[model samples]
Target: MNIMKRFLKYTALTVMILIIWVAAIFISMDKGWWHTPFTQDKMPNEFIASVQEELQNEFVGTMAIALFKGGKLAEESFYSNDKPADRNTVFQVASLSKFVSAIGVMKLVEDGKLNLDAPVSRYLTRWRLPHSDFDNTKVTVRRLLSHTAGLTDGLGYAGFKNPKDVQSLEASLNKAIDADPGSDGRILIGVEPGSEWRYSGGGFTVLQLMVEEVSGQSFDSYMQSEIFEPLQMHSSFYQWDENFQDRLCDFYETDGSKAAQRYYTAQAASALYTSLADLEKLFHLFDEDNVNQKPVSPEFQKLMWQVEAETLGTPIYGLGTFLYTELENGGFVIGHDGKNNPPINTAFRYNPVAKDGIIMLTTGSTNFATRIASDWVFLQTGKVDALLFTMQQGKMIQIMAIGSFFILILVASIAFVRRTGK
Candidate 1:
C-alpha cells in the first residue's frame, strides 16, 4: 500500500511537470517567442487561398505559397505530401543561384573592390576569357553580369561538365570549349560586349570566377556568409555533400517521372538549395528600408531595382533581381525563376506595388507549372485585399491527448492503490 502511494505521487508529479512544460511552450508560441512557422491555416488573406486551391489541383508536385502586403506576411499556406513543407524544406533552386551570385558581385561593385568596366583578364592569373583571335580584354565584369559578353550558354554548360580535373578557375578556362555540341559551346566573341542581350550561363560562370578572384573567397563560402546569413535565410545554401541529400526534396522529370540525381560543382551561376519561406524573406528586402539592422539607403536599394538594360528596350533585368515589369494590372515586381536539372522548376516573384507575391518550388520542370503559376497570379490579383485568421486547432487536439493520458494514468494509479491497500 505504501509503494502504491509512492508510485501515484511520482506519476502525478511527472504528469504535472509535463503539463507545465507544454503550457509554457504554448505561451511562448502565442507571444511569438518561438519560431512558430505559419501555415495556410493562419493565412488571413483571400489571395493565398486562391493560389493554394489552384496549385493543389493543377500543380502535381509539392509547393508552398506566401503572400506579403506592405512588407508583412498577409497570407501564407503550405500544401504538400505527408511531409509538411516549412521554412526549412530545402529544394534545389538551380539558376536562381545566378541571381544570388549577381548580388555578391554587385556588393563588390558597391564596395569599389571591382570595376565594371575593367577587363576580367586583369583579375585572372591563368587562362583568360576565350579570345578566339579577338581581344579577351574586351570582356568586362559589367558585360558578364548582363550576359552581353558575346559568350554562348552552351560553352558555359560544357565548361561546368568539363572532362579535365581542373581545380582552379584558371585551369577551367584553359579547357577547350567544345564546338561539336553547337555554336553555344563556342566561346569566341560573336559581337561587341554590351551590344546584345543574351542569356549566357557561361557569362554568369565567368562572373563567379571574377567574384572568387576579387573577394578572395570560394563561391560557396562568400555567398553563405555575406548574403544569405545577413538576410536571415537559414535554409539557403549551396548543393554539396551527400549529407544534404537527405533533406533534398526529390526531383522529377518534366513528365513528373523521378529524375536521376546529377551533380555539378560550379556553384556561382547555379546550384543552390532553398525553401519558399526563405525566398519570401529575401523579397521582403524590397519593401523594407533596412536589412540585417543596417539601413537600406534609398540610393543602394534603388541600384538593385535600377534597370541595367536600356538596350534590351525594357526593365526585365536589374542588378541581381529580375525586373518583372509586365504583370497585367499589378505594379512592377522584382524577381527571378530557376531551372537547373530537367523537371526541377522553381520560382519566386515579389511585387513592391501591391506588396504581394508568390513563391513555388516544383520537382517537375514543365511548362505546365509555369502555366499554373501564371493562372495563380491572375487569381490572386482578383482578390487583391485578402484576410487571414488562425487559432491553434492543434493545441486543442494536443490538450485532449495530454488530458486523456493523465486521466488514464490517474485511474490506473487509483486502481493499483486500492488493490494493494485491500
Candidate 2:
C-alpha cells in the first residue's frame, strides 16, 4: 500500500511537471519570444544589413531578396556562390508555380473560357479524373484551386533528369512516376469535395490540362500569351527554352555541390522558371491601385485571397495561395512558398493592406528562405505566423524529448504499481 501511494504520488507529480513544460513552450511561441525585434523607425539600410547578416550566419549560397513597400520595390539584394547572380538570374520556383497557375485559371474565367464553380471535368477532354467513390461532380475548378477536391495524391514531383523522359501531361496525370503506386498515387477523390483541404499537385495538373483544352493551345504557350505577356514577365516560362540556358541559376545541393537541372511534365504544378526582375512585375498583380489592364478582374482578385478552407477553424489556404495570418483590421498576409529536392527554397509574402512584402529565393540552403521570411513577418506584425511553427526545429526537438521522457516515466510507474500490488 505504501509503495502504491508513493508511485501514484510520483506519477501525478511527473504529469504536472510535463504539463507545465508543454504550456510554457506554447506560451513562449505565442508571445513571439524567439523573434527578432524591429521598429518602423529602422532605416531601410539597417533592415537590409540585418537580413544580410542572417544570410551569412545561415551560410546561404546564391540568394536574391527583394523588398516591397507601398506596393513598390523598396530594396533589392543579390548574393552569389562563385558565379555572378543578379535580378535577371532565373530560378526554378517549385510549388510557387501553382500560385501562378491559379492566376492563369482565373484569367480564363474572366475571359469566359472557363468557370470556377463548374465541374473540372467539363473543361477537360484529353484526360478525366480516375474513378473514385466520391461524387466526381463536386470536383469543381474552385475546389481544385483551393485543394478541397478530395484528391488524395499528395504528389511532390521528382523532376526528370532527361527532358525526353518527361511524360505527356495526360500520361503524367494517369501515373506520376514519383507518386506512390497505391490509391494515393493517382489523382482521385478520397473524400467528398469541399469537405476538407488536402494539398494535391495532381489537382493543378488537371487545371493545366483544362487550360490547354479551353485555350486550344499548349499549357506553356497559353500561359505565355495570356499571363506572362500581359504582366511583362519576359523571363518566366513553364517549359525550358534554349534562350534561358545562359541565364538560368545553377541548382545546388545543400553541401554546395552542383545539381543537374530537372525537367517536369507537371508544368502547372512544379515547373516555373522565373527571375527576381520578373517576379517584381508579378508582385504588381496584387496592387489594387494598378487597375490598368489587370490579368484578373478586381472582383476575382478579391475572391482569390478570401479564405476558402480552414484547418481546425483557422483559415489556412485561399484559392491558389496561403493565408499565413489575419491582421487585426481583417486584412491577410498572403503569399506562397516553394521547395524542391537538391536544395532549392523560395518564399514570397506580402500583406496587401500594409503594402509591404518580402521575396527570397535561395540555392544550396534547405528552407532558408522561409525561415527568414517568418522573421520578416514577426518584425512587421509583432506576431508570429503559422509557417514559423512548422520550421521550429529546436522547439520540436525539445517537445519530443519531453514526450519520450514522460512516456518512460509512465511505463516505469505502471510496472512499479503492478509489482507492488502483486
**TM-score top scorer:** 2
Candidate 1 is scored at a TM of: 0.68
Tens digits of per-residue lDDT for model 2, 231-312: 8899999999989999888788877788889899889988999999988888888888886467777787778889999875
> Model 1: per-residue lDDT, tens digit, 2-41?
8677777767876776677666755553343432222223
Residue pairs clashing, model 1:
40-77, 43-388, 44-387, 44-388, 45-386, 45-387, 45-388, 46-386, 343-365
Clashing pairs in model 2?
A: none
Best by lDDT: 2
Each model's lDDT comes to 0.59, 0.83
Clashes of each: 9, 0
Q: Please give each candidate's TM-score.
A: 0.68, 0.88
